[model samples]
Target: MLRQLRGWSYMYEKIFDGIREQAHVRDELRMGLVCDACDLGPCTFDGSTSRVPCGITPDEMAMKNLAEKIAEGLGEYKTHKRHITMVYDMESLLEAATRMVDVSRSYSDEIDKLLSPYRTVRTVPFGLGGLRPEAVNICAVSSPRGIHDLIEFTRTPEAAENIECAGAHGVNIVSLGYPGAELAYQRGIPCIGNYLVLDNALATGCIDAIHTFGSERASLEEALKHFASRKGPQCELPEPKMHTTGATLDVTAINRAYERGNIEGVVVLFGAASPTCSWHMEGLVTDLVEHGYLVLVTGAHMYEGSTDAMNAPGVVHIGFCEIGKMHGKGFAPTPFVLVPGWKNAKILTSTLALVHHGYPVITGVRIPLTPSIEEKLAEKGCITELNGERVVERISELQSHREG
Candidate 1:
């Protein structure tokens, strides 16, 4: 109930009731990203303009957007972790994609080694119920780098004095994506909500500010003073509910079940936390599991569900989006992926890099034009379907082939 953005509390009921239904500025993303970087034309390349004053065709613009997103995620690693890699560009899209596939594996291995001891899961509180009306609420809308210090220091008493200064009152990791999951695993730092729940989270009239790293920034001091004095009925938070990560699920049991004809092929699920996408993804899991395939869930999609899904008979909740990326680059025997939406820049670019590697994907996003690299993948190359119905058919057909 805490996750619901609907009318849970009569006091702050309308704060986020009608936001999602609002009309979007653009009709649809033609291929890559909608260009709003300049004043010339905020175009979707809907065949309205022949030549964009931005000096790039729709194809070129898509390629550029893809490269930028990959660089953005990797660049963060460089800044905080001191990780370095050879940087390449526009014409070198294919080479860059190959490098991303290779380097990301190394990064996965490194992070695993550094934090291996904290892998096994346990039960943790899920909703806004744990929130105290008196204490300040600061959501950590953070990245791996941003949340690194708090998790690192809080391990011991002496080191914790540093982070215990401002964040000592009340703090919860809001939607830090993959890093948030990692933080939850390392120490049971409660992650209240993902990207979808941001609006209602702040609207609770008690959330003081956000501790930003990526897109969401913390509130300023002057603004916070008014927050305490602001007039409104504070919504009463529910009693905390228990959610488990491990949830008594095992991967080897899945592999053995596959051998025993109890399960068919394995499918890995990930991507952005769109409510529509998540609902469909959950449905896909239900359909796939019923079809006798073990569905491995991850990213925001995994967290958005009840423990019943996480602990489902044929469903295994993998670590986070890193597993999703690893699955993209033909991890051992490659598995099929369903990326329903790419609203986030990182996911969009990550999808580009995966497709550039010539891996076949079943996504609802329409690239409009295939890249030169995907062109090399040929008849069976990167498939970007726009219709959701056809996406299901494509996966069903592919699953049947795997069965055969």
Candidate 2:
């Protein structure tokens, strides 16, 4: 459906984050599991159990795939820039799926213990500034790793020589998504937005050269070092509902408001893109609030389809998935919960973490990982089916116990 993100990657002889944006949308929902475990076939199926030539069932393939996604999610911390003592045997999920171990304790304990330090309320400044007009702009998008990569390379003499050649006052850097509020605490590098706004930041025409530094993509050096001016018109970003804007999960505020019946409960959009297929972004959020749940549309979902949605009374645009969504996870035992769309790897980490904490994560997919895990999650919350009505019904049911 999203035909062209950035139309001139070839013109610059350099690829940008637009490619990843397109793939994120494609693989998360549209493409199901594919088993290339055997050379006989890279057979694709709709997460079914029809056995392949390699004797691996789709059920088995799904478990392996799920484990792999968790591993990739954990890799986000490798360059985490801080020490992490907590450990999760994520393979335990696969083991439990196969009945090797009774689903052990949720990973939420470990993740929460680790993230406890980053929980303080903070403002993450976004929207294209902090660049020296005379200097070259070294822009990067993708994983948190890409931010690190941009930092490391921009220091080398090789980079210095290039900026000197351009007669600029050193390179001005911009990092996207990670290290915004939680991880890095707003270093000089200003983050434009989450993964969803990668292309949007590029289209702003303020950035100079884009880099995929933290990416293992080949020839990143060329991209980091190259400058490609836009031949097309820059896109206009709409004014935000608030200026000097900030969004953070205030546990005390939420509880006080709920007790007074200001909100029935909380609904967090965990790495979900909206407006979803069946619902407009604002419509879904407005519906949730009307049902008495305060809706926190988080991460890329905040900007995926913006149209004064955040301006709605109950909606809060918490910046970046890792920071905002993790706060939502902290509410596991308290009843403030996260609602996730099984979108991507970062989302997989957040969703599984919440599931570990015993939140009944409602997703449209009937069988996301395995029937067993889905079944157990369903026990906590109903599996949403058909349209936004199911989700609204679930919200009503969850908040029904509040008695306010």
Candidate 3:
């Protein structure tokens, strides 16, 4: 994918590398204990030096910082959910809710039994009572509204796979949003990763049609100009060498997989922002699959092109938001692990949400949690700060528990 884009002088790899390098530099600067309250010298939080010049203890400062980060992460997701809700009419909104309920009901008895614990019916309008209002709102509002003429892209592997399959069946596929271009590449389908890529993809004459959603409309006119200007010979892009032939799993397939005992466990790979981390996760996922685990991935992990991982008998590519909804209803009957490559706020919040829902989540990233939050998670048997080896160890135990 990088090589093909490079032909058009699109420096996506260079830009991403620059961003990652800057992020590392920022992390280095944050290592010092700098007091944000006042213009004071950088203070070291040794046991002897308990308090900073601002009259706050090191523990207090840490807790405050953690709280702010959590708030920021939660706010981002909430705002995204609100934006989806604001765009659709009430009739369309209710139709989405009804569809979800109908889908849930169509499951087999075994699948239904597995979903009963987390199945939400209430707060869905004309359903049984006792569903989480927030969950229902999120699921309903975020549901796809109308039939898309162009390929409406998002941050999900399933979306890319669907687009590719549709295109193969004689449908016009064009990207409208950010990310998942790599996943599309696996199937030999061209897709845009972001607005910049959208411009380039259109200019290359690879995209058949374009559709903009949300704030993407702001750059529509400029993108169209680029699309219109490039009418010369089209470039023949190289196909990815290691393509996986696995089908993307939907909600019904997910339930059926669980009921059939085809999925032993699930491992979510986060923080695909950096090339190095993404490479590491690709290897890790392959290892997990070899050990008979059903590897699940979202975000940039979808584009890693780990053929071995995908070909592993039980691999499933899904969206992060879809997994969050599935968590509410006990999707993984066995234990699962959440692997994070970086200290990302969104990943932290998603991990917390899963832990809050009583899933046996083993976290790979070390998130700074308040004592209360840590204790609650501990009570639920959620472990954090596990390295790759320890994570696999925990998964082995969980698999054993399932078999026993």
Q: Write the per-residue lDDT of candidate 2 for residues 1-404, one digit (tens) a residue.
A: 23353445454444455566567445533433675432234455543435554455656667767776676468556533322223334444422222211121233333334444444433334444433345566556544444545555677787777657655567666665543322223233455544455565666654666665344233234433443333222324444321121444466666667667676666666544322335344566667777666666544334322222222336665544542244333442244344434434344444555555545456543334366755655664435453755667765665564344
lDDT ranking, high to low: 1, 2, 3
On a 0 to 1 TM-score scale, where does candidate 2 land against the true structure? 0.52
Q: How do all models score by TM-score?
A: 0.60, 0.52, 0.44
Candidate 1 has its poorest 10 consecutive residues by lDDT at 214-223
Q: Rank the candidates by TM-score, best first.
A: 1, 2, 3
Model 3 residue runs over 4 Å out of place are 1-221, 228-263, 268-279, 303-312, 323-325, 328-332, 341-346, 370-379, 398-404
Q: 1-404 in candidate 3: lDDT tens per residue? A: 88786764657767777788877445423543433321133344644466654456666666656776676568558544554335444333323333233333343233323323332211111111111111101001111221121223322465435434432222322331212322232222222232223334434443433443333222333333333454322434333223232233444555565667565555655333221122245556667766666666544334333332332335454322223324444453533745443323334444445555445676554345567766655565566644555567776765575567
TM-score of predicted structure 3: 0.44
Best by lDDT: 1
Which regions of candidate 1 deviate over 4 angstroms? 1-96, 124-135, 151-173, 213-233, 236-242, 246-253, 275-279, 303-313, 323-333, 352-360, 370-378, 385-392, 402-404
10 residues in a row with least lDDT, candidate 3: 134-143
Per-model CA lDDT versus the true structure: 0.52, 0.48, 0.40
Candidate 1 vs candidate 3: which has greater lDDT?
A: 1
